[model samples]
Target chain A: MVVKTVEGSFAVAEAIRECEPDVVACYPITPSTHIAEDLNRMYADGEVKKYIAVEAEFSAISALIGASAAGGRAVSTTSSQGLLLMHEALFAASGMRLPMVLVVANRAVSAPLNIWGDQQDSISQRDSGWIQLYCETNQETVDSIPIAFKVSEETRLPAMVCMDGFYLTHSVEQIDVPEKKLVEKFLPKFNPEIKLDSENPLSLGVYAMPSDYQSFREDLELDLQKAKQSITRVQSEWNNLTGRNYGMIEQYMMKDAENVFVAMGSVCGNAKEAIDQLRANGEKAGLLRVRAFRPFPFGEVAGALNGKKNVAVFEKAVSLGGAPPLFGEVLCALNDLSRKPTVSSFIGGLGGKDVTVNNVAKIIVKIKDGEKRFEWV
Target chain B: MFEVRFHGRGGQGAVTAAELLAVAVAVEGKSSQSFPVFGVERRGAPVASFCRINDKQIRIHQQVYAPDFVVVLDEGLLDAVDVANGLKENGVIIVNSKCDASALNGKLKIKEGMKVFVIDATGIALKNLGKPIVNTAMLGAFAKASGLVGLESVKKAVNERFEGKMAEKNVKAVEECYNELKQ
Candidate 1:
């Protein structure tokens, strides 16, 4: 179907339909509410089956986990507090090696309570063991859902596809809705190696002493280590089908860049425009988009920034005592690299303060002006 | 290159106006960027949106300090924001109000070489869409004042944004706003 106007929520629904998930469990939250409503509508219309509107985000994930554990392809979505509410369950889903996909509408986590666009909500859960992909456009948001499912199920791990709230969520745009046949071809039916069944009767989540528990945790670490390669393989398959190639990191004009801004999610779109404008003016500035966050592609990032003289890492969330969370991760990634760029951290857009191209340009200028320190505005 | 700043309250479709303008410009094969800035995410809080359209890709992401066009969606915002602070010498100010352009201009103390255009967008929106939302209506006047985009493009964008009968109503509002500015 040709979709002329689509909100980020509906775009997600369209992708879910294409993926043909066996079960969809979601709770209603600001910005994400429409996604649930759209899926429910599709379910009611008989376009999609086995859609479950759950009571809470935790239950939503739990239900999907149960369904996925039973050898059914499952999906869920949440935002901000809802995502935080599902934190414990998120870990369980990953630990159990369940192949599920979650759609996260990135929203500001609150003490004062903000329901707007920001990355803190998802970034806060960086260590949840799920592969995280940040999207910059409505089209990317839609396309990522099935791709996420493909990657998640391929590795038998959960995945989170994140888009900014209200910015991509409520905002409408023209997006190409792929045909169901094409999606089916790209994402085949999900078949799991282990599942819940009466006949098989295998015990999961068994109590283990420290002796075995350490090895269990280590096994999970090994799987996470394997996910980096799995992501590359799955992305190749996706690219072969859709003709769009997205990696753990998407680099833009970074090959010859002197100054580069590292960003994730929708801000990279703005940052790309800033880089293009600066490049036109003889400023060798570019952007590196962090598409995959969890199995943090450290080597790829290090390689991308190897030749750059100055790098500015922009994070939407502050790390309280340490550098911005993303900055810390990037620095860790660059630890063993032969060439490391001078890294600076800048935090902005907390509670959705709008990081425009001008803000990024300012950072680039600061980097060029010999500012090696970190700042938050 | 032209930069426009829009001032309105949240939930008033201020960001939509900027986005629609950006899309329309992109449809014409030009480069444009639209983004919003605000603190209070809820409705009825002051919000500002910016748009830049140029022959080349736009890089500056800061809020427009010097705008070639100023679109004021609510008259109340005049008291709260410096709407005309950095308006270009030949810039035009479009206001969604019943007050005459000269009267509103005097109230704003618009600098010399600046032109002001005023329309009762709330009235038009109420008449056409049965809502007080004036973003689309103001966009129509924006097209007339700046001539950056065609009115047809605005209508198409509005039709694309809203669905069913609502899209028809918004398209009518776009036409009315366009004709109002023409007059």
Candidate 2:
């Protein structure tokens, strides 16, 4: 049975319930508050089990870390500054190889005090060693929750499901929510290979001497390297069950396209629409949606743009004086390709500047007409 | 294919209005897409949303420029946003206002042959829902003016969205607005 509803916050809560998460640790923040509120209400009403309201975002993640360590399917959610507060714990979660899932309501980091939508919060946490999946719609937001859990548990690394705040979080949309039985069928009980057990009394987070630290780090690197394949396998299994397929990257009308715009999150929807309109108007345009940002599907992305003439990377978050964050990654991914497409980086939608289809259409026209390094005004 | 843009403020249910319209169109077996272009706009600050309804799949992801219909949920936004910026010649403009349609024509520049429907949505909301939020009421006027979807479809959509007393009140408001348009 498919139920239609609005509000991504409630959608997240419903997905969490369908997944039957063993533990949910959350802290309240603007935009992200509704997600936690919905989850807490569900837990209080006995719709879910073990809802832990922590004092801070740090503690919220720490609780999930603890719960996951004890072999429970743990999850949590946060945004912007709250995510920054949990930065230290993020590294810890990755270092210990804990497969916890986090819902990051993407928000602009504050200094001038902007509570709007952007990707800086999640983009800044790129080095946190968690597998990040950006969602484009409320349906994708709900769909990614169960997928995140499966991917994280398979790779034994944390997964961050990021969506634009207010855009996907607070905004209401008609979302198709999967039934409980189907969700259960898709995602079975998570059983971690190595867990903290009192009977075994295994040592976790033990002090690593300087000499052995490198080897431990190497093992972590190997696990993350294996995550790329793991994500594909799990997503394939999920597709078999739900008939809704997702990937590390999803290419839209990219076949035989000359110009391609690469983006993630909700903006991809706008970009895809622009591409379709352009194509109908007899322009060769397409979109490349980066679903899995971490383990950064470099091979798949490079392969998608193999024959494209030009590519535009639209980054929602800026990297100070550097190139747009996602653009930089795209460049690095295609650095060694023998015949690479000319790439232009466009920085936009920062501090929540409505990146409309008009903006995307303009970008495509510019790229097709041979303008590079443009910024959406 | 028709694209409608709704301009209002945060907490005014502009996005909700778009979703309800999408559902109504879907009830007629037509394809529709409804999404909001969110901003840092707080309560009373200007926000905009878009809805596209067509007999086929809407593959264009662009914002609705040159919209066939424009619904102004808050008259106050008229000063800040040019609600008639991209209105087509045959388009319809539905506004929630107490002023006369000619008054809006004087204040705003619209193309010739474009239809304008003005309703005291604030008055309807005050009487029916006990609030000045005019999204639903203005949506009622939009359905009547544009004929994009039948009143029955919109009433069913509204009833599906709201429940009990609130649903009854909104359904009544929609029917009342429809009747007011008919006369």
Candidate 3:
């Protein structure tokens, strides 16, 4: 297959069409609209068998849940407020252990109204029991679709494939899209035995008595913990077919890094510039990009940050009235280390704000100056 | 690495121009990325876009702060925005206007050593494509002024983006403006 220059949304759409899911039900939202629109076009062309028309994000996920329950390989997409509307359904989809994939074009939640890129939408739902995978490039966005499907079906846990909304969605770049044969080889058709049927009558998601309620929640947690392994396995397996490697978290220039900045999604691109320039000037700086947010990858994150002199956790989303979410998590990951380094939390790029190379360089300087706690760039 | 910023109104094909340049560079076996600053801007609103071309893989996903070249599709944006912000010391400014390079230098009041190039792209676009969209025309001038992309590559890119008569007219717009541009 020849590499094509494409927008991130269009690449994801191509991957989705190649994946050939049984149903797609989504309400259009900014940044995420292209994904749904492209899928809609495929539906019009008879490439997809079912495309459900739902009124709201709430109904969108509910309908996908029904489709998955009826033995259909279901998929849907939403962002920000739409994700908020589908909150209950998100938990239900995972609680019932349904294998569905929700493509999230991550965007900022709004009180003042913004349509640009951010990680807040998906970060808010980090506890909703779905496997969250954050992507950095358009090529990664295309690859994550089938990897998502494979992992979701294997573990019976829903997965959210999140890419920075307009940053990647609107930007055009070079990417190699896998062919249909590779996709089919990677993911087989959804087996009917997984769904409800008259041949094998059973009860699911039934009301649990108090004695067994705690155990059910325990099982969900255990399944999620096991998902960390499956996520890594799928990435390696996909690498065999495509010759590209996507890790749970990526470490760049970490071999002798004295100061490290941790981030996710598109900001990593700018961070690389800061690292390169600082290294040129005899400074030891590096970056760690956390690709798997839901499973968290705490051990790998802590290991990468262990011996560094200082660390800065920067994010586009803030937890509001608390340490920013990513910062809090990184802190939790590093808390038990005997030789932990200085950790600081910084927030920038909120509400589609520009996360520039200079902003990243400033964060590095602040880390050197021994700044503690949160600072906005 | 060569960085460029494009200033224009929404629906003026500024983003399209950036993407076309990126595609052209990619077609030539280089790495490039292009995107709009006003990702969700409304039609007719002021918009800015950026592109970066490099022999190696270009990874930074930030706006073009210090651009090697800046293309202005509408002269009205000069008063409405800072058209000269963060321009390199020896940068080039390409404008789509009827004035000559000397008047553009006086109008923009650019720094010493900075070069200004002028093309009546709006006129060429109107004459050739029957519209005020000077993006492709400016791109043709950009290729000539910066010497980053060949004229044939620009024409092929424009042709790939548009179809039949529209593609032919846009290529004509590019050729006419690039040939007539004054520095």
TM-score of each: 0.86, 0.89, 0.96
**Mind giving the per-residue lDDT tens digits that candidate 2 earns over A141-201?**
8888888898888788999999888777865445677778888887879988788898888
Interface RMSD, per-candidate values to 1 decimal: 4.8, 3.8, 1.2
lDDT of 1 by residue, A1-377 (tens): 45444455787888888888899888989768889899999999998878887888889989988999999999887899999999998888888888898899888898889887788888888888888888877777787887888888888889999988877776545566777887888787888777889998996666889778888778887888788887788778867877767888999998889898999888887888788789889999989989888888888999999867999999888777866889998999889877778999988888878788788888988898656868885
For model 3, residues A237-285, the per-residue Cα lDDT tens digits are 9999999899889999999998899999988988998999999998889
Candidate with top TM-score is 3
- Report the candidate with higher DockQ, 2 versus 3: 3
DockQ of 1: 0.23
lDDT of 3 by residue, B39-104 (tens): 667788889999989999877776678988899999888778777789999988998888777776
- For model 3 the local lDDT of residue A98 reads 89
Would you give me the overall lDDT of model 3? 0.88
List A-chain TM-scores for all predictions.
0.97, 0.96, 0.97
Worst 10 residues of 1 chain A by lDDT: A1-10
Cα lDDT, model 1, residue A339 = 75
What CAPRI-style quality would you assign to candidate 1? acceptable
